[model samples]
Target: MAEQDWDSQTVIRKRGNVARVARTDSEINSARRAGVSIETQRKVTGNKADPGVHYQRIAKVDYADDVVPPPKLNNSVPQAIQSARQAKQMTQKELAQKINEKPTVIGEYETGKAIPNPKILGKLERALGVKLRGKDIGKPLFAKKDGK
Candidate 1:
């Protein structure tokens, strides 16, 4: 390419119409007062089934009223298990065999060193015929009560 005079070049131009300027605050307020909403329509697309169908607004949730709280683990679980095992005249080893768990695990539970999960707790409950887990009783450990 040959080097030409750079400043001698004429700028290309289109002559059709001038662009519209932004409206003033007073003009916008006047339009609002005349019941003319300047809001732009949001384009809704994606669903090939029906583009006119829009999503429903999410309803507010009342946590305390609408939600049911989970069962809280009672602190007396270890003692209850121990007492129930003794009441049934079953040793930790015997209880462990019945529940298909280790004797050490039973000992840990009895000594309040370990807390068993719901499945193991249920097995122990069935073997001992007691409710070892649930809401707090707020009673003495030795006080006998019906195991429901």
Candidate 2:
């Protein structure tokens, strides 16, 4: 084999794992000790404390006073729901069953205690055949012409 010219040298790249970077024995020992301590702490105290240490646990702090309150359902909504349900000769439980919702959910809406949910309102409208929301509360969802 002829020696290659310096100007035309073919380079071969090395593959596989490179040598680990040098670390002091004390540093390596400390890392191992820290790992073992963490494992032991987890076993002893469980994982609950680790989240608070490694990540911000927002739930642990009281933010209720800082947070804005949820909007309450209007009094008109309760009246509309109650009247419509009664017009159909349906009890709260029967209305809830018809809508595939819990009786408490229907009761809450009827009492205007639940937070307004459009999906629930839509379900109620379809089931009770009335409009529980918008400008025409307690009106038929789909008004029919007297002739049609």
Best-matching candidate per lDDT: 2
What tens digits encode model 2's per-residue C-alpha lDDT throughout 9-50?
665986776434325677667767766321222322325745
TM of each candidate vs. truth: 0.42, 0.55
Model 1 quality (TM-score): 0.42
lDDT (Cα, 0-100) at 2 in candidate 2: 88
Off by over 4 Å in 1: 1-74, 136-148
| Model 1 per-residue lDDT tens digits across residues 16-123 | 665333257787678778876575434555454665665332123334457765553455887788887887798999999999999998987777667457788778
Clashing pairs in 2: none
Residue 68 deviation, candidate 1, in Å?
Answer: 25
Error of 1 at 63 (Å): 30
- Scored against the true structure, residue 116 in model 1 reaches a CA lDDT of 52
